[model samples]
Target: MKNISWIGIYPALLTPFTENDEIDYPLFQINLDAQIEAGVDGIIIGGSLGEASTITAEEKREFLKYCVKTLEGKKTPVIINVAEQSTKVAIAMALEAEELGADGIMLLPPLKYKADDDEVVTYFKAVAAATKLPILIYNNPVDYGIRVTLAMFEELLPYANVQAVKESTRDLANITNMLNKFGDRFKILGGVDTISLESLMLGSHGLVAGLVDAFPRETVAMYKLVKAKRYDEAVAIYRWFMPLLELDIHPKLVQYIKLAATAEGIGSEHVRAPRLPLKGAERERVLKIINDAIANRVALPDYKNL
Candidate 1:
């Protein structure tokens, strides 16, 4: 397996859906094009931002296939998020992604039930063993209630395919410790949008951001500034984007982001069951926030609206 670098801005793309809650393949294509135009380094599909938890295993496979086919012969690498409740299911998805020509596989800790560090390590090793593709470990303790300790990541580093990690724990010390120890080996990607700039400044290779699903241009611009070593300019952009990033922690984040995308005319705000659309005053409030943010230059689109 080739080494996959998780550098620069990679949006955890939201799944586009029609009003009937069916996958809108055309809209999905448009969104992908928009992201590429905005200059993202890579694309992450079927992640938390993509509502993977609500999607079936078959849907996941189809989505990965579609993405690989769509981006075929392109420079952008596609990373498929294959985090299922069952390790077997996750491994199956990983193998399917590899077979479909995906560049890498990203996995989250088992969310249905919390497991100890040893179990988590074993789970990742099993998934990694299933395919020769590069693997990215997604560590989001807040959402999964499970933490992959620094030691755990250290243990998994021996696996040649385990090349990167998405650290969403929001603990600076943990990030510092990881960078201090394994900086040369594993590429660290900041999973939380809120801390993306800070994480980059602190030596994180890139961001796997959900907010970038809505504000790709600004997010990518900030990363570019940092890449140029212009800390002052990057901080200004980061501060401007703080409010939009704050929306990622919202319980209705998927709805909020989709609504924001709709406001920009990129896609619909339609989400799956157990994740209903924003309703009543709450809907209006979020819509206004998204619109106002766009007006104020927080979430500007790269393309001209029709």
Candidate 2:
């Protein structure tokens, strides 16, 4: 299995699409470069923010290959999201990610089907058994309808490759509970952007951020500042970032974040069908928030030196 630190800002990268609705590799590379320059520790492709459901498996494989090839000697790990409905397919995707040089895989519970606790564990265990890549359980019961409870993780303990978790439960105490119960067993990453700082303050290993696609510098700065115990500096950035971060919690987050990224000149608003560009008052409203933040964007300090 590959080694992943599972620490610092790992952007849940937004998939930039062309007006033709295909994966925009050129634009994608641009955003990837920007992320790297911003000091992101890792990259998560084909995740919720990446509009995973609409992205074809072929596209995902190609994207993974592109990312691996692009980051060849950069020392940044690219972890693909495995959000399949079946254990077999999930395992297949995980294996493919490993084959394509992904450092790890973030596995979600069986998608769209509300599996019980035991079934969820079985699904994760089956995938873990099939792949050598490290697994980060994406525990977002709020949006996904299934939570990988601590007891469930206890069952998954035997799988040594199941190394980390993207904690999006919106329940801060679970952070403490995981630490109290299992101490350093699984690295915990803050998944929700709005509460990510709180999660870090509670001892999360890192952040899987959404807005980082557009605002990578600030996002990375916030993480670096927090880790350096510069709470005041981190909080100032987080305060100005609150409105934009809230965009990650919505149902139309893919579109919303894409708009923000577009405003930053890093991405476009193009998206796959069944999902469309934000329009009418919604577009204007979201743009106002993005514009306001840009207008008053905080001047980042020498976070890189921290």
Among all candidates shown, the one with the greatest lDDT: 2
- Candidate 2 scores a C-alpha RMSD against the true structure in Å of 0.8
User: Considering every candidate listed, which one attains the maximal TM-score?
Assistant: 2
Please give the distance, in angstroms, between residue 185's alpha carbon in candidate 1 and its true position after superposition.
0.9
Question: On residues 51-74, what C-alpha lDDT tens digit does candidate 1 reach at each position?
Answer: 887887778778888888888888
Tell me the deviation in Å of residue 44 in model 1.
Answer: 0.9
- TM-scores, all candidates, are 0.94, 0.98
Q: Runs in model 1 with CA error above 4 Å?
A: 298-306
lDDT tens digits by residue: candidate 2, 125-221: 9999999999999999999999889999999999999999999999999999999999999999999999989999999999999999999999999
**Candidate 1, residue 296: lDDT:** 81
- Candidate 2: where is the Cα deviation over 4 Å? none
